[model samples]
Target: MTQINRRDFIKLTGASAALVAVPSVLKAEIGSAYEARVVVVGGGFAGATLAKYLCLWGDANIQVTMIDKNPNHVSCILSNLILNDRLNMNDITLPYTSLQDNYGVIVRQGLVTDVTGDDVKIVHLDDGDTITCDYVVLAPGIEFIDVPGLKEGAANNFDVVPHAWIAGPQTELLRDQLHSMQQGDTFVMTVPQSPYRCPPGPYERACVVADYIKRVNDGDGHVIVLDPHPEVTIEKETFEQAFNGIYKDIVNYVPNATLQSIEINPGEKIAKTTAGDYAGKVLNVIPTHKSGKIVEDLGLLPVGARFAPVDSASYESTIRPGIFIIGDANDSGQPKSGHMANSQAKVGADAIIRMIASKSSSVDFVHDPARLEKIRTNSACYSPITYDEASFLTAVFAYETTNNSMKLVQDSFASSNSPHWNKDNFEDMFIWSESLFSNSFT
Candidate 1:
């Protein structure tokens, strides 16, 4: 790991001189006198990253509190592999104890029933306690969009077709269905519309599941993908190439096909789709999504009712002051992924630190306007396609300071055949998970 100096960090900002400021250290006693409390909602990738970075980089004058409904988080990033049995759910599930023990962050297991700019009130199911904070970070993840017939199925015939997008029981139900399928039976996968979490996740699931079926069922099973998007962003060519060249006999890819309704035949143990009535032994439906219900209940989203609009520069909600939204919940052009969410959290943390520092009288005289101007830009690096099971293509985008339009700096494909993909990438993931857990719960 390279040590990130303040100068290098500033350069990464892409901001003008107006944003950079000298790092200051305050005595513990002085810091405690005016410590600002930060409350983070949702313990997923974005919320956890922001909370961790704030405690790691911000002044000691800041106290962090993280609130979440679940005590442990199972990452959606790698959950697709779990469906194929490539990875177990334990590999992605992380507890909050590490965050509490390591970072000294106050972690409360509660649901944020309501949120305002200055204070957030959470309802603790364990003991019915309400906790409030000064600054709140909202990263409650996303809620599935109610596709009319889809909800009807979920309420009634959930055993036949399952939307395993959310972790826990839904995931296990889908996995069990796949395991129970006959060797020659068909399996159907439906990809949701754009702006969903992990653009390549559905495709990845298809690949991994196909690989599993080929290995176990001796290439007797068939897998079909129904994509709502006209084309996939990641590995479109490569995926087509693989499907045509290697998995041609077993895998079928259909694009621009919207799934209107799901007709489950319990007698035949099959599912029907909009393209045609195809019988399948198992069905996995990835539905359209919006900001989670908690966020909607808190009235954080805009009039569109899709995502919460925020200033791209700060990730601060336009509708609510002092409340920041990151990850899939925010209406940013960036693809919703754990990697992008982590990057945005760092930027949000830095902005909050700058905002807090600007209020101090001692820093007023020494504040350099030139440096402050330089701290406004943020960038994101996304790995959209995984070439094989190991590596893929990535896009690096930088946000313009004035307009916030994303500029592609590097959009190229890369392969990682080395064992380091598992070694280094897994290590990085654990570090990220630990940091988030600590920040949110400690």
Candidate 2:
């Protein structure tokens, strides 16, 4: 096997092509004995990356405490491989040891109950522990909206219809269920409304499951996809080809199948929706997602909005200047993917360092003309259409002074052609995903 490194990843991801990296070390240089504390609320791709870079780029005065419910983060990126048996939980599990040992970031394992304060922030934990800080970043990722009939089903039985979206024990349950498929058994899955965590994720899951079933059953099992959207969400042509061309006999793609309720039973599950009731041996129903619980509990979300709105240049909450939201929680009009979250963390980290380095605790520094021009972010993701074939997409966005928001650069947008889905791209997917996992966590 060929060895791939982070340098190769930067070139493939193309985030550096738009100059997204800002030198926070420069911010560290101009500070005296001024000390600042940053408390990050979650330790996924967004919060962990912010905490690690804050200590690495900021001066010794930068003290960061990361509070997460778990000591390790199981990445949703490359998790599809787990269903196909190419990878396992250990491969995607990232610990906080490096952040603590190498960068001096304090990793606190607890659930954040409430966050209060204006100039200074106080993070309240469920265990009655509170951490005071100069700035607080909310990167709790996402939470799912309850389906009409899921609560009762879950109460009666555990994980009857496993979504496996967050990628942990639920993921293992879903995989084990897939492994139990008989020769003619059926697997049914749903795609929630748009603006969910990952745009291409549902379709990718369908393909991976179909591929696995074909291999084990010799093309006897059936795979059904129920998507509410009009058509494919992202990389339309590529996924359409995979569904219709490669796995047509085993896969069935149904559009505009709005999910209404679900009925769980001992041997089979049925999804009741506008399209019709689908009876299958296994069910994976991913509900519509919203910002993390903390964002909604703290009243950061605007009226009738699912996510919190923030200034794209710095990712600082418009509702609360000193409080920042990154990853799937923020409404920045960016794709909610791991690569994008890592990029947004860099922008947020740089802005926070600059604020403290100025020797002023005021939050108005984000409006400076020079600071806005330096704002740029990019995202790249590779989706596996089969167990050994993949497709990819890349996009770059820069802060537009006219709109006061980030806009996609038409020239920088690129996606792999449907015809290019081959073995080479499949190999690149593992390298790309592994590199991203290492770069953000390690």
Candidate 3:
């Protein structure tokens, strides 16, 4: 069997030695020019960040192009707050014009059909257009694979089970269902296993929904979270406090509860779970996911649909060079969140710049052999534990460095009681959103 190593592959490309000596900024400029065009597919968190950074900091010589199926993107990060009426959808939705106006990025509103190394051949509205480049960044996010019996109209049931994790229509559907529920009604939320986007999302959704039920229905409606993990990975202390003190009577959190299968009858508005059968006015089933289908189709992913394995530091796919994967699509052990995606985007953008510069110059840039041996990759997630209070939690993990990998680092949890907490968090949320929006779209 032929063996391929990340470091060996980088060196064999003949650009590795030049990459080590080239500065990131200069490399980016060279790659952004016509000579070193860069095509970034998927205008979500990862793609947008990569495009913007490459344009702003990359060598001016490179021409950066960003492509996506949609012109406007609604963020998955803040969509959960919409369920509790904490935020509106419009606040999170952003248009692509900012990328064109603010940054010199060429925006292509189309679907990516295929990705070859250094060449992204796409089909736009049934018309084909191929863009050749020095590097291709694949950040198409994730797609929920249709399970055997978990798809719309799969079992002759018109009833819909919304996985609001994807944002947009599915999110609106879940919100509508929640609002339509009567008092004393029940809602079941299922959390998928590890390696999914937003490790804290399912728990955060439960908290927000429970808060809504307490306010509107006076603790009449019930929320049961069926978690596959042994314990919640985020805000555990704060969540426990919220559940015990605020929604103690309303929410039932059942850990180690996995979904065996589902029995849905649309006519009767009924569903059955492994834990027990319940007739709820609404049901939210967030199933397992894999890299977006396009990744697999382009032969960028490995055998299993779990994730795209890549060089740990650079995020360049092991299967192909000149192709990078970030966000929820990559096999990095980090929690799949917009924050981490942005971080990884920076690393990927820098790596691509180095690779391009090496190719242009005669210098032999040695790739870092120890780049993948880093100690920690951490992400912080903030969840509203109460109507006027929220908790900031951070999870840290040592990837490929230690056997006992996962570690939880608890940040300060601020309640509404603290005047400073509310003020700071409110300002922080807005600034974070604006920063991301400005960096990506603007």
Judging by TM-score against the true structure, name the best candidate: 2
lDDT of each: 0.63, 0.82, 0.66
Per residue, candidate 1 scores C-alpha lDDT tens digits across 349-436 of 7667655655532222222344334333222221212223332323344555556544444522232332212334433333443443
TM-scores for all predictions:
0.79, 0.93, 0.81
TM-score of 2: 0.93
* lDDT at 437, model 3: 57
Name the lDDT of candidate 2: 0.82
Per-prediction count of colliding residue pairs? 26, 0, 18
What's model 3's TM-score?
Answer: 0.81
Residue lDDT tens for model 2, 238-293: 88888898789988898989999898888999988889999899999988888998
Ranking of candidates on lDDT, top first: 2, 3, 1
Please report how far candidate 1 places residue 403 from its true position, in Å: 1.0
Which 10 consecutive residues of model 1 have the lowest summed lDDT?
378-387
Model 3 has a clash total of 18
